[model samples]
Target chain A: MDKVGLEKHTSKQFDADLEDVRELVLAMGGLVEQQIADAVRALITGEGALGEEVVQGDTEVNRMEVEIDEECTRILARRAPQAGDLRLIIAVAKTITDLERIGDEAEKIGRMSTHLASYDRPKSAFYQIEMLGRHVREMLRDALDAFARLDSEAALRVAQQDEDVDREYEGIVRQCITYMMEDPRTIRHMLDVLWAVKALERIGDHSTNISEYVVYFVEGKDVRHIGLEAMEKEINEGAARRRGD
Target chain B: MDKVGLEKHTSKQFDADLEDVRELVLAMGGLVEQQIADAVRALITGEGALGEEVVQGDTEVNRMEVEIDEECTRILARRAPQAGDLRLIIAVAKTITDLERIGDEAEKIGRMSTHLASYDRPKSAFYQIEMLGRHVREMLRDALDAFARLDSEAALRVAQQDEDVDREYEGIVRQCITYMMEDPRTIRHMLDVLWAVKALERIGDHSTNISEYVVYFVEGKDVRHIGLEAMEKEINEGAARRRGD
Candidate 1:
């Protein structure tokens, strides 16, 4: 429930700069989340134009990343941010990189959707993909919420969803491979589906990365590469101490 | 011809810290490069043991990334570095992320190699994978060299190799799809090879990121997502102006 304390700085402009950058990140995240949903919907519904739109929108995403990066560097140079502010800047840098990558993956899915548009919709696998897409979109949303609120506990919860997404991805891949074996004619379409699914799995990973950054920004800990249980334990222990305080 | 100019710092300890970090990044790069080679070799040669070793060694790579990250953060906090020093710290942070990702790709290749070991060596596609692996490995090595020497020009050259790697990867994927159609019995093995090749392609991408980081470090320009030719033009213009200087 702790929000990022934006009003602590004596310099109101510094607080405004941080707030503006934060809003920009959330806007970027919202756009990326929509892209993932649209790309997945395009794939399932065989909407080629929607897919193309998603691809075109990626340029905007790239532009935002560059703009935000420059803003961060400017803040760093002018402010020489320390302590929590420095961690916030670093975390913002890492978060935007993951968001931009999520945009790229969504664009890939969009391309795959256009290709899949030419083929008959494979109902069963497409359903699984839709489900996976929904899972990751929620994960993305919740991670951004955690970031906005400085909710390390919520971020930890979001991080755990990654395992479920990964398992679902594997099951889908196995099913798709089985389809390829049974019907040789479906190889091209199935492979496209597999690639699209792979992109979804990677989106899940980037979501996990964003949540980790939330923890890093809030807790001032580098929780990357650590296993889920350990991350959870560390976050929970920190929460206990904070509650005691 | 330009080094990172570590000697510019007023504090001798700050200069020494920068030099130490630079060396640490190079050492990490060296380990990652070897991991890529061993992983690819294990895939091509069906050395499951070697693949396992590569997979196990990833923890060490992850450890290096974490250690280097802490060091960079410490330097940033302590030095409050300005201009080139700030850029160097930021670029180092970004570079370690890419290198860590390259290591992750290598580990995935290792896993795929272990999976691919059960089947007979499919010579043709495996050769393509090997060549593609070597191509990316070179890109990575050249990128690290660019970082060490602050050679933006060399970095641009390394960036160009990514396209060739991408083309080769596509060629391999297409050929593998043909193989899967010709013989469904080879589906599992061919898919494993395809995944490994995908890993190789991603390694190329990470290499390109590193090269871009080098360019950023040397020229103080954000050249990413700008396309290969545009990046070259910008770097060339920088070099041209520097020559006049």
Candidate 2:
């Protein structure tokens, strides 16, 4: 991990800028994590007000994204950061985009929560949705923690957790389908749950994306588009090489 | 329009690099457009082989994305592009991401096509799916064209087209629900159609994302996270200001 420490630039101001960007990213990550939690709670508890609050909070997330993007662009233009510094900026830029998107997905879930609150409680379906949401929220938290620590291994673990979330999401979908088929009257409500589950699935993907960016920032490798198996292998080999050094 | 032209850097090699990236982006765009067409055609025609081919071709699109991304990073590090040049690089980076994800969504649709082909054809549902696919494919094509020409107005039109796609998507979902409720045996097949429609809806979103990138590249304004109405207003104002200039 020490070998992968942040590269020090000659200029102190450039270093300060880099640190500032990381803090902002973490701040944004914290807000997103909260949004996910609130959205999920709103869904399970049928608390429309909490869901509405999550929806309103997304605007702040969007504003932070723009601010971070501008800062990254300014740094690129002014400092002309090389190698690791450049990768950090690129990773931060990409990460915030995913975070903002995650916020949007959470807002979608929040809106669905509001709508579902008006309907009869689908207790069994709510359990699965809550379970999947918890898994995704944990993955997101681990991804941010990985980024904060620049721990590629932690990032890899976070990426792996996505599979579990995906499985859970599929289970929820199947359950929703069963519920819908059992009673035609519950079709619309079940569809809402399905969409909410889909949103959670997407959030898992965005979390995987953020983890990929963390690997790229630290390892300077592009792990995207490659299958997960290959990515895992690459990350493991990189870890071994670091150990050898 | 001249006001939005690419900025000249002091280094000629930098100009060459920018042109090279644009060409690669256009190349990737062309491949993605074909993928969308082929995937949809497979869905409509029930040509499983065609869908499989589209799935296989995604590797090429993925390769191009990595190549273009590396080029952008290299140029940013070596040239330290400023102002419009910086924005162009950022936009290209963001655009390629959306393009790649669009390819993934198309692949998902292609996979669904293969699965649905094996199942009995849901003829009526296929009609709506085919129509929505055609509209989304066109929007994607127009989005790529707008990027190629740096045509902001064309990009705005592409963005606006997404609403129609969304409306059609909702209609298809409703139809699928009705089909499922009327016959429980068809629920599984209709779910497949529903998933395919969801993929198409997502493709529209990625297309809209690309269009927003184009507007950002040309107008130097970030239109993302802003509602479509605000985006339209902003683009119109930018166009008006350009006219005054």
Candidate 3:
């Protein structure tokens, strides 16, 4: 092939490589989202066997993280991509770490669910775990959607949910302690519920982390560890400047 | 200056940048280690005041992580380093993340310690949390030691300790359940101890992740998620081949 044609072909290939990894990330996210849903369902429905399935499902999420990471490393080494491409690679690298940890949290919930199965309950999810679980699941789904669309504004909105989740988490902890203190018979059961709730709280944090990476990818900004208000102000300001607002 | 001299001069500067970032990672690691120690001590000594200090100390660890991350990103964008240099930068980027998370776990323990303070304990670390905390602390220190020396061998050893930590964590969980079951009043306090032990277990996981990054840096192998046995065999075999053994 002529030099121009060869150059164009290589660029096309690089785009394809990037696209492939992006799809893989969404797939991984979908799997993780399911894991959380299933694990929480198991906890609520008293389906101990389903909890085991969720535990096994983690292997796939872990596999996806490693696979996505290797692809990013390969692209970085071979393409030496600069600017936006480099940031995408870095953000994907960071995002998958959060996703993997989120998977770990899901697995922990799954394990707890299995243990909670034997402890007879109302055959419905605890009110607190259900509430926290629903909020966290939504956050994870929206976080992945934002990444897929490269939507920084949506990422910010989703991240704001974390504060509510934290409040819910704290509420549950206090409530659990009250229950355990009132009746020692419920101590074992309440403790298990608390563990499930703790895992849900962590999943919320990881979802927030995923949202931060989306903003990082789209805006070329690192908003991590910064307070939510500051993160919001800077991103909005940057957007305003770009729009000549 | 001549072209060759200019090339050499730029290379020297690149090396210095890499060295600077490496030093920063160790500094960050040292700070995280101290946070864990202080947090655990607070729990054991019933020093609620110290626990608050440990929680506040986490802000410094978070700041160091962001600073280190920015430096690494600057190097990557400007240097466009290849092969070993690129690996070093990427590994540093990843290592600080685990260190930051280890700091988070310490902060969690700190928070739990503060809560446990009011419950009136024996003025000694609960035997379970104390034992588990000591083991995890050693692992963090050794993981940092391995990173400093680029000693994958040491990293492998430290990573292996994670299993023992896991077993100890399980033991403590069982023991805590027994204590809470037998004595109703101890439920609240034992639950707090459980949270502290849970945080220590996660710290072990984060320390193992740091060790995995060290292995990645030295061997250019991504040993994460692979069982420890596989990680050990590959690293040892690679060492043997390098030595023509």
- Chain A (alone) TM-scores for all candidate structures: 0.97, 0.96, 0.93
- Cα error, residue B164 of model 1, in Å, equals 0.7
Q: Candidate 1 overall Cα lDDT vs. reference?
A: 0.91
> What docking class should model 2 receive?
medium
User: What is the full ranking by TM-score, best candidate first?
Assistant: 1, 2, 3
On a 0 to 1 DockQ scale, where is model 3?
Answer: 0.53
How well is each residue in A68-187 modelled by candidate 3, as lDDT tens digits? 988988887788777778888888999999999999989989998999887776323376678789999999999998888887888998889999999999888888777777777887
Off by over 4 Å in 1: A1-7, B1-7
In the range B42-103, model 1's lDDT, one tens digit per residue, is 99998999999999999999999999988988887778888888889889999999999999
lDDT values for all models: 0.91, 0.89, 0.85
DockQ order of candidates, best first? 1, 2, 3
List the DockQ of the predictions in order. 0.78, 0.73, 0.53
Candidate number that wins on DockQ, 1 or 2: 1
State the DockQ, from 0 to 1, for candidate 1: 0.78
Best by TM-score: 1
Candidate 3 lDDT, tens digit per residue, B1-245?
Answer: 00001012357888788889989999999999899999998988778999999999999999999899889878877877776777788889898999999999899889888998777664333766788888999999999888878888889999999999999998878888777778777876787888888889999999999899888877878898889889999788768866779
- Candidate 3 residue runs with Cα over 4 Å from true position: A1-10, A123-125, B1-10, B123-125
